[model samples]
Target chain A: SAVISQKPSRDICQRGTSLTIQCQVDSQVTMMFWYRQQPGQSLTLIATANQGSEATYESGFVIDKFPISRPNLTFSTLTVSNMSPEDSSIYLCSFSGDGKQDTQYFGPGTRLTVL
Target chain B: AQTVTQSQPEMSVQEAETVTLSCTYDTSESDYYLFWYKQPPSRQMILVIRQEAYKQQNATENRFSVNFQKAAKSFSLKISDSQLGDAAMYFCAYRSRRGSNYKLTFGKGTLLTVNP
Candidate 1:
């Protein structure tokens, strides 16, 4: 398993604001994923971030709303744009290595609260 | 598409006792993977156990074990000698082994409470 960390741990933002959550992994991984867990809800895949290529968003997620950046194998960022109360949720990042593609290790998660 | 379901919204167990959490999934593919992830109040997703669909034997990790019934599409986690640290939100996840379908589908989660 890889050691993963997220920046800011948590944050509170006002409506219409934007916040960027950074996910850093200890080792290089092939695929990085971003997931959103809304209040009392299950985890939802936001997108899949692959190094050197544009991210692939899941259904109901768009580039304009949740922009992702995979600058390298071990780093990725997910920015929540035009935030509202409905956007408040815990955002998490996970990664799967070459030999361990079936399993994914997760970060601590960034807890966002919109006011 | 795959869907994971955690039927129990909440479960309680006395400390040092055993408890079982139920999970069932719907998937057309035969080869797939199921996982039990624990999220404490800290909100970090921790992998508790994993079971590969092809394997017949169940997976065991110390006191944590899974009962995987491939035909029944049922996967359940049994915790022995439960402790305070064991109380958390348990989520059942399913992933397809097919190519290009690497996303995980998670259940709504079962909040486990360890009563002292």
Candidate 2:
């Protein structure tokens, strides 16, 4: 199991502002993913942050609204751009130490409240 | 694409009793992984147990065990001697083992309330 730490465990922001959440892993991982859990909803995959490349987003999400940056194997960040009240949700980061196994370890999660 | 479904939204179990949470999945791929995660009031996701598709024997971790019925595409978690600490929201997840995607498809989750 890998230890994942996410910064800004929670934050309250204005509707038009943006918040950047950071995810740091204790060990180097091959694949890093971002997920969003809206109120009373299940966790949804936001994007896959690959090191040294553009993030691959899911069908319902886009890079413009959620920009991701992965400078290296152990660190990544997800930025919610031009936030709104509907964007209020818990953002979680996860990664797998062994690529083929597909067992992912998740962070504590960042609870974002957009006012 | 894979999807997971947890039928029960809420369930209550008496302490020292046994409880089972149902989970069903849809996937065309034969090789995959199934996981059970627990989220308490602190809102941290904790891995409870895992099941590999290729393994015939079910996975068990202490008081937590899984009944994996591959033919039925069902994976349920069984908690024996249920304790107060076992009360939490449990999520069932499925992952495809073939890709580098590492994306987990999760169910809506079942909130387990343990009565002491």
Candidate 3:
């Protein structure tokens, strides 16, 4: 089990502004994942970040809009660029040791509201 | 492609009683993993229980257990001695055995309201 934390617990930003959320882990993990969850909706995978490699984004998400950086095995950042009302959601970061399926855990989400 | 479904949107149960949350998934892969997550008002996704496709013995933790049927593609979470703290949004997830499938396919989620 890994303990993860995200910076900027909550933020209210005006449209067109960008916010970068950082995720730090207690231990070095092999895989870091980012997810977005709209109010009262299920989670949607944004991208998979691995150290020293470009993040693999899922369909309907682009690097220009949601750029992710995994500088090392224990840290990563996700930047929400040119935010809009549609981007108002809870951003979550998760990590797993050895890239296993069950040892994975999630960090407390960063709630963002684009006004 | 894989899909997870949680037919029940919301369920109410009395405290100290048992409650079951249903989950069904569609996948072509034979080897996979199923998980149940709980998200309370805090919005932190917590892993409640998980089951491997190859393992038939149900996985149990304290008061949380799962009934996984591989041929039926069903994984349900049963919470016993439910407490008010157990009230939360429950999600069902599926993952393939392949290492490349890092992302999980999640269900619509079930809101469990534990009434006093």
Best by DockQ: 1
Q: Is candidate 1 or candidate 3 better by lDDT?
A: 1
**Better by DockQ, candidate 3 or 2:** 3
Model 3 DockQ reads 0.87
RMSD of each: 0.8, 1.3, 1.1
| lDDT, candidate 2, B1-116, per-residue tens | 78899999999999999999999999999998999999887777888999899999999999999999999999999999999999999999998888565688999999999999
Distance (Å) between predicted and true CA of A83, model 3? 0.6
Query: For each of the candidates, what fraction of the native contacts does it recover?
Result: 0.93, 0.79, 0.89
lDDT by residue (A1-115, candidate 1, tens digit) is: 5799999799999999999999999889999999999999989999999999999999999999999999999899999999999999999999998468889889999999999
Ranked by lDDT, top first? 1, 3, 2
TM-score per candidate, chains pooled: 0.98, 0.96, 0.98
For residue A77, model 3's alpha carbon misses the true position, in angstroms, by: 0.4
Which regions of candidate 3 are displaced past 4 Å?
A98-101
Q: Report the C-alpha lDDT of model 1 over B17-53, residue by residue, as the tens digit.
A: 9999999999999999999999999999999999999
What CAPRI grade goes to candidate 1? Answer: high
- DockQ-sorted candidate list, best first: 1, 3, 2
| Candidate models: Cα lDDT each | 0.95, 0.92, 0.93
Candidate 1 local lDDT, residue B94: 96
lDDT of 2 by residue, A9-113 (tens): 999999989999999998789889999999877889999988999999999999999999999999999999999999999999988765434677789999999
